[model samples]
Target: MDMEERVVGEVLVVRPVGKRIDASGSADFKGKMVDRINRGRNLIVLDLSDVDFIDSSGLGAIVSMLKTLGKKGELRIGGLKETVDSLFRLTRMDRVFRIHPSAEEAVLALAAAKSMAKAPA
Candidate 1:
């Protein structure tokens, strides 16, 4: 799986340029995410606009990424196609991830959350 990684403010945006995230790409996807997290990227936004399909392994890899982040980081998903959206909804993974219509929206939301966290009580 080929992914483009960039930073927008404090969020790390990872856009995977692949039509399907199945058994073949799941490991790569998970590894990329883990690498970002290990490198001190606490805010991650996955841009999945190009991904049209994902299998159980792919979903499991995403869940594993979330678990790896734990309370130290956060993961958000954006630009989900119909097939991918249905899979997430059907599997109740939508509730586990913060889904957005676009990567820009996810970045904005994450930025707001970061600001809020830094705000003084």
Candidate 2:
């Protein structure tokens, strides 16, 4: 799992430099994300532009990581290739998870949601 992470002001921009996110690669990524979330850095933007394929295990790992982040913080996926996007659609995970058309847009949207939640109702 080749990855690069940086804090863009408030959001963590994590880009994986890989063509495929298989079981092995995904497990490592999940562990890293869980560790990050546990340490209180849960807001994340996953750039999937370079990732072309993801198997069932990979998708499951992503979902589990998102669940761990929960409501306090969230994981947003962006830059999905058509093939991977189709897989998410087929599994109905597209509706379950936040899919962004672009990483920049996702960062803004999720950040907005977070800010709104903090506002008084």
Q: Write the per-residue lDDT of candidate 2 for residues 7-74, one digit (tens) a residue.
A: 86678888888888898788898898888789888789988888888999889888988899888888
Q: Would you estimate the TM-scores of all the predictions?
A: 0.96, 0.92
Cα displacement (angstroms), candidate 2, residue 84, comes to 0.6
lDDT of 1 by residue, 12-115 (tens): 99998888889998998899888889989989999999888999999999999899899998888889998889999999988889999998899999899989
**Residue 34 in candidate 2 has what lDDT?**
88
RMSD of each: 0.8, 1.3
Local error of candidate 1 at residue 81 (angstroms): 1.0
In TM-score terms, candidate 2 sits at 0.92
- For model 1 the local lDDT of residue 8 reads 94
Cand. 1 Cα-lDDT: 0.91
The model with the greatest TM-score is: 1
Poorest lDDT segment (10 consecutive residues) of candidate 2: 6-15
